[model samples]
Target chain A: MSGPAYTPTDEELAHLQKLSSEFEPEVTGPLVGERQSSSAITTEYANADPVYRVKTAALPSKYSHYRTCRGDGHCGWRAIAFTYFEALLRLGDRNRFLEEETRLRSMGNLLNSIGFQEHLYEDFADECFDLLRKTESLVSAGNDERAAAELLASFNDVGVSMAIITYFKLLTSAWIQTHPNDFAPFLDLGQDIRQYCSTQIEPSVCEIDHVGMSALAEVLVKQAGFALEVLYLDRSAGEEINTYRFDPVSNDGLPLHNPPTLRLLYRPGHYDILYKMEDVQQPAIPQAPLHVALADYADEFVPMPTSRGMSDVMSLIPGMYPTGLGQNWPSVSYDYNPSPIPQPQMAAVPTYTSVPVPTTSQEYVNTAHHNVPLESPVGMSLNPPMTIERGGPFRPSMYELEPGFQSNHSQSLPFQTSIFRNSHYNTAHFLNPDFQPEEWSPDSEYVTGSRSRHKSASQ
Target chain B: MSSSRSQTPTKRLLNELQTYQSDPNDALVELGPVSDNELTHWTAVMKGVPGTAYEGGRWKLDIRIPSNYPNAPPEVKFVTRICHPNVNFKTGEICLDLLKTSWSPAYTITTTLTSIQQLLTSAEPDSPLNVDIAQLFRLGDFVGAEALIRYYTESERWEGRQSV
Candidate 1:
């Protein structure tokens, strides 16, 4: 069973002949000026051996099934030993397979019920059938030694590979080594089967590949069918016919094979002979952990009420809490005493202090504290805590004022005109671009956030 | 195991030339059926396997290649009635890798003819080739499949010559 006895067609021989001729003409380098053709790659290949030589040897009575049996040597002890070795290797893991099967069923993954187990049975049966075919041929040739205990050992190899799913590659490789031209074709089929299997099934260290399924799936169905077709055209075994067709690239099995996938080929609730032959060792993933009396952490996670422990927090910002700002960090007004209006607090801690209030309008505190002016809380400054004033003057330069209050406060506070003359303010560009007459007027109208509205109204 | 060959796609098809001298006494390997042909162009037939819904059913296929003989594989299609994942039932295009990607110089028209024959034999109703037949096959009434296969395989024999 190591290799199939094939009779190559005449067309196959001509293909090889064409290959030899294609490379022969350009083999040697020309003496001087011979124009070289672009297809001289074949010329480089000329020195190599001409391939596709058919080996004609009569195996002893052992190969009587194939008409190619020929014997020109001594006793066939070597062939007997090789055959026995193959048998022992094939069936070596039967005990392990049975043990594992029981283990998988105990865990409750019903692999024993699917078509996979039948596949295994089929592999074993096929091995037995092939060995029988070979043994019968040997017995017919009168080589009883080939039919002895040693001759059956070759099946051991088939058994091990079948259990782990390496049978197809081993068979393919044996075919390829003798027929090197078939290497490309073998690899192509191998890879196609691999992708197809790898698609539907996960990669396992020991699982037979998907190609085995492609080959075995059909075989199982046939043996299981046990019936023939009507209006049959013909039946023959001599022709080299491949009854299975699969795609290599586009025929990739479902893409979830390598990913985290659990393909229940069949639903739970059925178990039978077919399931026993399939791969039973699957990575077990449980639905939920068993309920043991473990300590519950829920009681420890109860948060302590720290805000209730504080006594001064309520007095610091006492106010009517704003009804609706719809913000997580909304802030209340800076007014110390309770106001008639329920204040909406700020969304976040202020980045800068509030602008200073004007001497006239009390509504202009510099929330965005800038270094521009000083307007101490009207004699009651001690009641509210504020930015500790930096040493300087009462003018806008002395007190820290926010830029928001710049327009109104700048007009009220006198500029440090003397400090400007001494410093870089002496530069001509730094001088007021529009030098309007500086006038003091209480007549300044109050217009908060609507100077344009007033002007447009007037217009 | 012995699967890949168990199922038989029922359906007989012969190209324009059925006179290739078939030896009836010799066991013949199953191959695809003829769907269409001329003097050189030819189609093949294969029957679906039993126990499956496509059992007793026939499938048609198209097989044509250049005169290069076995140097390149022929393009084979499941033309008659296909209701599996690997074939398009309506257009009769197939998705088997041996046809397109895995084709080698050694392959012949005969090999693909049989492989597709087995494919149609074991029709996976879960993976359908035709949207309509796939639906019908899904309900598990494989009898419909057998009827459809007969229609496609037999009706085409008349349509083929009439259309030409």
Candidate 2:
């Protein structure tokens, strides 16, 4: 290498240096883009190297959806922060939002212990807290679509988004500082943790490195009982993207079962959110009302002559009606024995059926018409139909008589018998459209034993 | 969206002004908006750090805040000329990372001014805006650097006082 033929003078050199120093790569896009199909990623990589094509081709199958974060140096932090609130929204739990607010607020002590100025950091922290409250209200109101839209809108606001990112960055710094033993080994020889944090973690223009990501996962994601997963989509000679998961654990140190996970797709220097098919599943909450209403209608109106004929016709269609039809129908008909049943069960059924279907013709006209008002009393009458139906020739189990019995039974009954666990009738079985995994509970183990014995004796 | 874009910075600036008013830092001679109607453009007066070569000098700073203040850092520069490694003598532009990439929403006007005052006592010669002054400091010629700094500070101090 030799000097250029026309060597620049000092003044020219200074101007060139200033230009180079001021050079910023032109960045364009929303701060956080709308959720889009991950298949677009596959298409983007289709013309690239074979490795990228292979990896991205496999991406959509596992991670069905992805949202892009603007690659202006804060993508990783913004991705994690956006996903954290999004994971909370996915939970759709009101108290979880409050609990998270309190948990983050209490971390002020952590922030304070590390000498972070409270009054200064509080402005950023307030933005995060305000977002949580806003999302909490939306989730509480059962407006998840609006909640999600509002979340995307909030993050798109540069000031609000940067505030949250700054707050999270400070938290990550504080966490790393407090847990030096966990992170110090990753630093250069004898490098001060505080120096590394100020340089690499706290700077607004510094993208999150691996160490910062781990600290953020520990401080924010894991503490909230949500897992954090990073999928490396690089040319690492693999057909599938490599995945690294940080699972939240119970107090006993076991990874929590099926915890809601926050996932990020890391392609060298940038990060975007990834979603498993299960993650974007319309929360079972909205659908549960429709299911309950149909189940209730079937229970109440099945005893009526016309509706029984309709169900008989429905049963003729293979797989349209659930199995055990003969057993359930006989029991339901038995319950219709004009025996002057329990006043509570009679009142519950009539109240639901009467209010929703004002005219007799409307009741029999079409099932779809009842969907609107049927959703209102889902919270109230979910268990009553099962209770009334169980008040037949078969002895009602103590569990069935309890409030919230249907949900508990639906979740746990698959485990009561191996035959049921393997059968399509178990909602926990994968063949079911609304497949829910059978969650094992220590309290339910005893109930399972008693119910199994009672059921075996009845058989 | 536009209203909210301005509202957050204005609110934060007001809160910062109140905090600065209630508990002012000793190093800052005065800090506030240039005009009551405009919060984004302001002025600051800082006393040079004690026991430094630039001591006994009053430095006026031009502070131009972005619409998204706190999120985006305020631009602070010297209005009264002084000689230093990290400050441009003619342009008054500073080379501190705090006003650039390292800026955070946590920093307020008072805290930033305090940092600027601190920057006088701890000049980084390695990444300097004024190559001539930085060369003096880099060559371990502190006496020469101090003389040049004092000459500029004292001469500029008189000019600054007259202008005020």
Candidate 3:
């Protein structure tokens, strides 16, 4: 059957006009934008039809607010793609951010393996990557708000927005082929997977079905570590859209708190962003999981193996490993050697005093490759030669070293510096510019030692 | 396609134009906007394949890209006469899946024209726009089909010059 007749009568047109006038402006730009409180929807339906009344009444508690999209056939894809990029921006961590960029670039291989010609989809992928790189550079320059504004602008820009949407379609198509077993059973028309993708999924204006949504969720969850929650709002006999969460991973496998999970609202033919109204008023992001909310690589705090890795040897011989130096630990010495420390003498050395080793930036670079110099007494003892008492609070003069530390690293490893120059703790500590140099050193040393001790014990 | 029409045709058409210019296809096909200033209306001239019954034939097609463009496939009609199972003899309408429900934004004008060229070489008799021509091709009557196709092309060439 060809379904209903194509013609729309005068009565039907009038009905459509009346219905549209009841709502605000129809979405005309990006898939989703302009967030409004749940009250906006609910209040409009207060004296209206039973269907909208029921739908809006259920929205408040579950979904505090909604961001409407353009309602174009590509709304589902646009909604999800925009949210994905927004989530990455919120993450603020350069390492994970760059890691995601590399992963996204590699997804094109999946498109190639599925017999898709490069010309059809390469430009879209290139455009998407270009925006990501541009946003990353802006973010690295410490213009976070500007980076965010630029991202929003790109979503509305004609060329970049559609390219990103097309890229999403290609991603879904590739996903269908690589994991046919997962989606084949769900195909309703007895259509071959490729035929279904080309006909229903690849084309613009084709609304997402269960298979499309699941395939997208699978790729996102597995490749990008994103956990998505979709709430379906429809004409069913319910007060609200049914909520479905797609985690597919336990907390143990993810970063500290699993990047702030993305929430979206799916109304039969379209998708929109959902927000917890309560989260908006809070101080931007303190309650948010640090891994996603802050941009600094959590590598500084991530504990190393106590027995096998160099961190283990560094733990045993404290003076050799530059602990509490923050991101300044030369990547070569710490990252180069993963094998366990073989020498018994090195392993037997208990933790040494936390002493401030003042060295020129050149000295740090010179000693980066030589482990022998690190073990020498010249490296252990410094200019003032102050000995930090063990098992008690040891505060090294952080205030005095802060100026030198900043200049030293930026000069030695210019390219390695990130927008987040210091670890979160250092940023908070340094906020108090009046923190006396005498008191700051010993206290921070004790805190650093206790933290390392805690890490070793946990391991 | 109509209710949720997107505003992407002109931009997409410009992109396709750039691509065609940067990497011109083999001499078999040529396509561009009907007028330099009007991007929505395009014209394509494609050469028939060498080893086929339609060999040495050149076909002109009027390509109208709706304001909605890629979202709704371009409307293609043969301006030159051709005898094929899947192409309408009366209205010059095409019966190709890429121009119908299988249409994807991924398909450019070049790809669509290429598909039409392929149709000339190999027509699917199962779903034909012209039933009688489809039956002739289906019965494997190459001699009869070739004679009719040649007659149509010859007359089309004669009319083509007169109109010009």
* Candidate 2 pairs with clashing backbones: none
Docking class of 2: acceptable
lDDT of 2 at B5: 38
Task: Give the Å shift of residue B62 in candidate 2.
Answer: 1.4
Every candidate's DockQ is 0.02, 0.31, 0.15
For all predicted structures, in order, the TM-scores are: 0.23, 0.69, 0.58
lDDT of 1 by residue, A71-140 (tens): 2110011122222222222223233223322332232222223212332233323443454455555555
Predicted structure with the largest DockQ when compared to the true one: 2
The digit string of per-residue lDDT tens for model 2 on A153-209 reads 999988788888999999999999999999999988988999899878987778999
Task: Write the candidate numbers in order of decreasing lDDT.
Answer: 2, 3, 1
Q: Candidate 3 vs. truth: CA RMSD? A: 19.1
Error (Å) of candidate 2 at residue A281 is 0.9
- Which ranking of candidates, highest TM-score first? 2, 3, 1
Candidate 3 ranges beyond 4 A from true positions: A1-31, A47-55, A141-144, A237-240, A248-258, A278-459, B1-44, B47-57, B64-75, B84-91, B95-97, B118-164
Candidate 1, superposed: residue stretches over 4 Å from native: A1-459, B1-40, B48-52, B55-60, B67-71, B78-85, B124-128, B135-164
TM-score per model (chain B) = 0.54, 0.92, 0.85
